[model samples]
Target: MHDFSHCQIVLGSSSPQRKLLLESLFPEANVRIVPPDNPDELEFTGSKNLFAIMRQLSQIARTKSENVTSQLLDPTATYVLTADTVIFVPDDFDTYLVLGKPPEEDRDGVVRAWFLDHYLGKTHHAMTAICLRVPGGTVHEAFVKTAVSMEVASEEMVDWYLSTGEPAGKAGGYAIQGLGSIFVSSIQGSLSNVVGLPLRETRELFERVVQNGDS
Candidate 1:
């Protein structure tokens, strides 16, 4: 286990899943929840390439870290970690579907219909960008891609899951770590990625910064 006692760790996210994972991974670390004010997630929309999307996510992480650190004084001994997760499915020859969180009001059922149409009988990618910023102004970042295959869900199953309100704020209308896990047939990469954070990659980045004495 890495010793995070040397400095305070600030998590720049409001997601409950990310918080849970981070705390579990670094139980001894002094983790603080200081979520950024604005995520500004819609910066890149015209690009259909997966790399472009991942890069956009990295940009969001950077922006979020800067937003949080700006509020702290003498943050030289603090490490601010920010992350973003995106789910995408190939739509056609040259485009993909970037699933956003369901609309809050969702008065017309568009969000619910979108969830049912796109996720059934499909394989999609979950890309997560994790960035770590040190006091020395060094930002170490990486993105992990996980391929997930979901079974063709019955209408009844979708209705039941959606009625629970679990998919409202999730990226792809499904939470692999929650009630939505039953719809997943297989996953080719880190399961943690589907849950919003890649554990191995996160540790690797933390260790890299620690080894370089940047954390």
Candidate 2:
């Protein structure tokens, strides 16, 4: 059993990468992981405006967290978290499929391959929406964005990369934190955000939740 020390931190996803990312800060056993009943959806507005898209993801994250928190309310439960990540190309993308982990063909349906082709050699934004549901009814949220530059990718390169199977379960077609890191040339914002969560912003939110001491 994990220790429920200090405050109970519930992560609403079962991604080992996310768990590892969080543990990088609090160590294993410091946080509790909770998977929500339904996965949060990532939607894009007609505009490729990063800020607007971030706000949309934030609202959906808040709703998901609320739904889970309400169901698992311990009355004394400390904190519950829900997050979503999206990637948008620069120049107001106007044409990128905001992605999540690609679903298995058997379950996820056919995901268009063109989205990956369009993202190559372009700068993209990774936005993470963090929702902290504290004791009582107060809810806190934060959104962070990171800029990523894809190395000039060849059709052969994308094909080879896809063969590795790492992109299948990542928000973006490429995972900067995995074998796909080779596809990136430079990153201007939070690296972790590109991976799915932003550490600095996440830590700040953690402190705020700790100080608020709701439950």
Model 1 over residues 99-198: C-alpha lDDT tens digits?
7676678722654575567767878888999989998878999999999988987788877887888887888777899888988888999999888889
Best by TM-score: 1
- Of the candidates shown, which would achieve the greatest lDDT relative to the real structure? 1
What range of 10 consecutive residues in model 2 has the weakest lDDT sum?
106-115
Clashing pairs in 1: none
Candidate 2 at 62: error in angstroms?
0.9
Can you list the residue pairs that collide in candidate 2? none
Provide TM-scores for the models: 0.92, 0.83
> What are the runs in model 2 whose C-alpha is more than 4 Å off?
1-5, 40-42, 45-47, 73-75, 91-97, 101-116, 212-215
Q: Candidate 2: lDDT over CA atoms?
A: 0.70
Against the true structure, candidate 2 reaches a TM-score of 0.83
- TM-score attained by model 1: 0.92
